[model samples]
Target: MNASVDTAGAMAPQDVVNLARYPIGDPDSPERAALVKSLRDYLDEHQYVALPDFILPNARSRAVTEIDAVSHEANHNSSFRNCYLSRVKNPSLPEDHPINIFEDTSNWILAYDQLPDSSPLKTLYHWDAVREFVAEIVGEDRLYDNEDPYQPVNVLIYNDGDRSSWHFDSVNAFTVTLMLQAPEAGGDFELVPNLREGELDNPDGIRAVLEGKGETPVPVAREPGALCIFRGCTALHRVAPVKGATQRLMAVMVYEDQPGVVGRPDVNETIFGPRVAANG
Candidate 1:
């Protein structure tokens, strides 16, 4: 199927995305096909793809302002634990094992449910063209916006003394993230590409990273407005601590291959504070 603009015609994909650089609105367009192929190839090779300046400047600026105004409404939490973001201890593992070792400070998060109805971030996530483009690039027949209101989208805010501990996202196959604001120093997105593949566990590899003795993780240097598509299920990644006064803000766009998938109530409470009644 040829990728086309949204049926609603409210905003063309070209206007929201940088069509001149990365054409993806029209699937019939050679540029769009080539871009999708390249992105797929990159993901297949490295388990992730980073698109710099994917969002246009005006739209990005507006989104940043809108998010900043409501930043205070976000929930915050801190934890010390392994890469999976879980603090549970496995009695079978050694005390010094990576699974048991805790490093890095707890980072703050701003849940997406807090955003106002008119938030640009929400609008962008619901765009049909954007969803279609992402589905095509990820080789999914179709993608649906997450049914879980709180887990559907969010912003990770890293303030001073805030950093995410190394963790793997085994829950989701792919993650789409955008940088809204960056701190003056630190706050680099680090990843050990393909550290674990398929269902096979790489205990030694995970240990090496936890012990700081593994291959140097690659640091993704991204500017505001950069879009990153990551296969987090296999690639272990984390955000370094924020420094200076500026806080690091990132938008996470969540999607699912099937409908009716909501986040676990316990997990949702941990990440997004209290949960509201499920959407009808």
Candidate 2:
């Protein structure tokens, strides 16, 4: 079998050669096939897909509570602002460069690679079900396993007024954002679909929209349990600042190719540090 999977997510005959050793999708069924096709079509033209209540119905509540608890803990334990994987500072990039941009306080937090095995978020360390789902979507034989993995878990809890600026993923793959809870107002997810064909192209066009200089970008409002898969590498996207008194919490599942790997001194140093570079 070939290693390539088409937009339909069907593997090429050549990839079938190694199919036995590599499990693709799980609980392979007609429903799963339909879900795969829907996601593919959505991304092919629009660069995004929303699977409402994507987690198995039975697991939905647990996932929500678990994510919320983690959000609560991170808010109290780490820097008041964003918290990501620990990494070294980048001297190569100019201090003013976007790569070097770091917030003094962030609304983001890393869920993977946490210390003290019993931490609330550690359940994700062995979240086999979630790992399998992501692998199938990315057509990877295995989930990323470096540092944290090409695919890592993160939780963002935006308490009133928190917002993530517009930016593109530095890698060549997609990022999945699952909303666990949303504020009463604001906190909408916005994107310019398929803007990035690949590579490290900057998504200034999408930025132009956010700046009110271009056409309106597509918006996806993530309700509780809404799982959105976005080609962050190509699509320009951002979260509107949170509004209302409630917190807007989301679980971001990130994935990239092996080639897009980067080593840093501390993961917590960058706003998007856990993002691996595209394969050379």
Candidate 3:
């Protein structure tokens, strides 16, 4: 899996990833094997893992430049919703119920189709070794790139004051992301692990947190060029409000369990904004 011998259509590992440290391209190397095992162990224990400098700094800069050129076109969304993603209050429930608590969230996103072909983001995502390495870390036999035109990859942009509200992913699965840029302050990621890991519901724990009376979820810091794998499904997580002038950018990569999977039109429209919604 050396860069010189990479087959057609695959990006050179060193071009995007720091192979000297991670050695993702060298599958047989003991260092790579141990790295995967340690990553898996950490994820198994914390339901999340982040590898600093997973992407080369220069490549990250290029990806940022590419995004800045199209920043004006990024899809913008701002809304107030409960963890369940419902904007309306549940009148049937008490006013102080978790369902009645709404939180503010805002951000912009660049869909996969919007990125230019020269984007290093695409190069890293297109690399099979990257996907295979992710599979190993997540304990999956294999992972397939999402076939959807707009969902396969995306750059999540968080400007000053932007944040995501505490919420659980509707579906239970792993989400992969790479940090391209980080805000000067705030924009911290907080996770409350296993909030609803199984059918069992920890109402007291969830209700306490929603009421701001529970244990504070520790913030996880990820620097630029870091790759993060998170099991946010069933876990209440959120990004704190960003501060300062620097924008926080994270590349979210989608990997499906099955092949040929595309996004649902209605949901896709909600995430990708009017551009894809109009064309789709």
Candidate 4:
């Protein structure tokens, strides 16, 4: 991504993402086909793909500004959860089991409602070409925007001492995220992919990873303007505690296999806080 490359004139919202390298707008182009195939190969092998320079410098800088402005209104969440993403532990399992292991977690969540319709994030999330490209890479026949008041998109802010505990995403969904800014130190994204295979419960493997013994975790390299697609259903992932005064900003966009999907009430409450958690 050429941080110094300046576009002489005004560009469209989609142009914010470097279409020159991605060429996603032209679905039939040979370059677009090659890009999809390349990303698929990487995702199939590693269960994750990070495309750097996905967004231009102007967009990245503007997104950071937009997110920072509303960040104070974001819900400051701090708590603990096990790898299973549950507040409660399984007493039936042994103490050393992964289910019983808890980790500290903290972050600020900027819900979709906080952003205006003109927000660059909304433009990127609603773009049909970008959505279609994501579906193609994930091998989904078609994907629809998540129809939720606050769950459709979010800006996750991690400041000094904030971190995400290890957890698995919904087994049936793929996660798409865009990096807007990076902190001075720490705040690393790390994950152990394919730790659990098939239907068999890899208790020992899970326990070993939680205990930080075997199975080294892979650290994902992402810079501002990078777009990432990852299948985290079976992976154990966490954000290392951020260090320094600068805050780390990342935007997450949600899409569904089918239309009319909304988050569970309880889930919404926990993530977005109670003020706007009521059913719409």
Candidate 5:
């Protein structure tokens, strides 16, 4: 039942070391062609891609465990709201461009600088594996390049109830969600794709949903052990109320335009407590 040991019962203790314990990708096996092909097709035509056994089977189990632990540790009595974003230092674009305009309140959580390599919940935003897959689908030569070469990775965990509202992520490219655990009911991920390029820009789409001015967002039910990859930058999405005692758990790996970038610090401290710097 131990993650570190292989099938033969050989004790390889280091094999199970968390994110920091191991490198992001194995350069020797640089690309998984079959995986890239299928993933590319899924991303091209659909708003989301579901990858089974995406993580090492053992690692997936670990992720599930960590997610449950965080949910149990949740301040249930604490204010239940919608979505939590990784904290950044300067959330205000200009001196006073309505900081409240960007304010998001979805029952959620953050695992930014606070989690360590040892923490299974730490967001591993490694771009190598994802970039390769994306490049294959979007055509590396055609996709938009990140100004920064080495992109920073961050993981997001959501534990919300009926109050979890609809919203969109600021990052504009593909967003990866690895389902570590599934809720019994509700908790479906609904999306309004191409909002970035369509008549519905994110701000307006979110506003429409909040104001009840438009139709309901499209729904995408994510199952445990399935990788949910979607273009969320502009798309409006939300986690419907999580029913049953078991909370929904997902390992969200996100890439940023700027590596090592942190979202609003005050927000981070407010929700997940103080930030803990990751060891480079």
Candidate 6:
């Protein structure tokens, strides 16, 4: 579909996305086609793709400001989690076992439902062009935002000393994140590609990563306003602790293969809060 204006008269995809830098709205454009092909190929080979300055600088600055202004409202949570990104403990295993090692931490999150309509990040998430472009690059027919309002979008914040522990995604096939701000030190994203594909039990490999004894994991360059597409289900990854007083901010866009499917109630309550309501 051609780009359309939203209620505020901003271009559906253009106002938010830097089309000249990344022509995701117009698939027929040669630049768009080439960009999609290259990104897909890179993701296929490396299990993730990073596009620096995916959002224009001015718009990105606005997003950062908005998120910062609302930082006080963010819900902060932390807990110990295993490599599977779950809090469940296998009591039968020894404490030192990778399956039993739960050292993951959490960061603050502002769910989509909490974002106002004027939020640039929220508007961008609802754009058809953006969704279509991501689907094409990920080799999916199309992508659907989660029916659960809170699950579809989020602003992940990493304050000083905050970090996401090493783990894999539990549900989504892929994750699309845009960095809005970077701390002065740390908050690096590290990934081990294809670490446990097709294997249910890869304790040795998991333990190696947890123990920091495996092959050197790839460290993704930190670029504010960059869009990162990660195949989290296949690649084990984590966000290093934020070191400085500055907070790290990112917008995480969640998509689903099926339509009208919201996140489970329990998951919603766990991530957001009890006041969370279903999108429908």
Q: Rank the candidates by lDDT, best first.
A: 3, 4, 6, 1, 2, 5
Q: What is the lDDT of residue 60 in candidate 4?
A: 80
RMSD of each: 3.9, 10.5, 3.4, 5.1, 8.5, 2.8
Alpha carbon lDDT of residue 14, candidate 2? 23
lDDT of each: 0.78, 0.54, 0.84, 0.84, 0.49, 0.82
Error of 1 at 83 (Å): 1.8
User: How do the predictions measure up, each by TM-score?
Assistant: 0.90, 0.64, 0.92, 0.93, 0.60, 0.92
Q: What's the distance in Å from true for residue 215, model 1? A: 1.0
How much is the lDDT of residue 199 in candidate 6?
55
Task: Tell me the lDDT of candidate 6.
Answer: 0.82
Model 2 TM-score relative to the real fold: 0.64
Tens digits of per-residue lDDT for model 2, 1-280: 1123122432222232112222223557666666566666766678787766544332445555555555545532223221112234568856543344443323755445332233222233234545555566655666652344322556677877677666666544767777777789988888777654645444344444545675577888666756787777676676777888887877776544453444453533343343323321
Tens-digit per-residue lDDT, 41-112, candidate 4:
899889889999998888788778878788899998998888878879889989888888899999999998
> Which lDDT tens digits does candidate 3 get at residues 1-280?
1244224543455788888888888778898899999999999988888899988888889889889999889988889998877799979988877788899999999998788765788778878889999999998998888878788889999999999998877753898889899999999988887777666767678778877788688577699999989897767889999998999999999888887889888888898887766795
Candidate 3: residue pairs that collide: none
lDDT of 3 at 211: 76
Where does model 3 exceed 4 Å of error?
1-11
Off by over 4 Å in 6: 1-12, 277-280
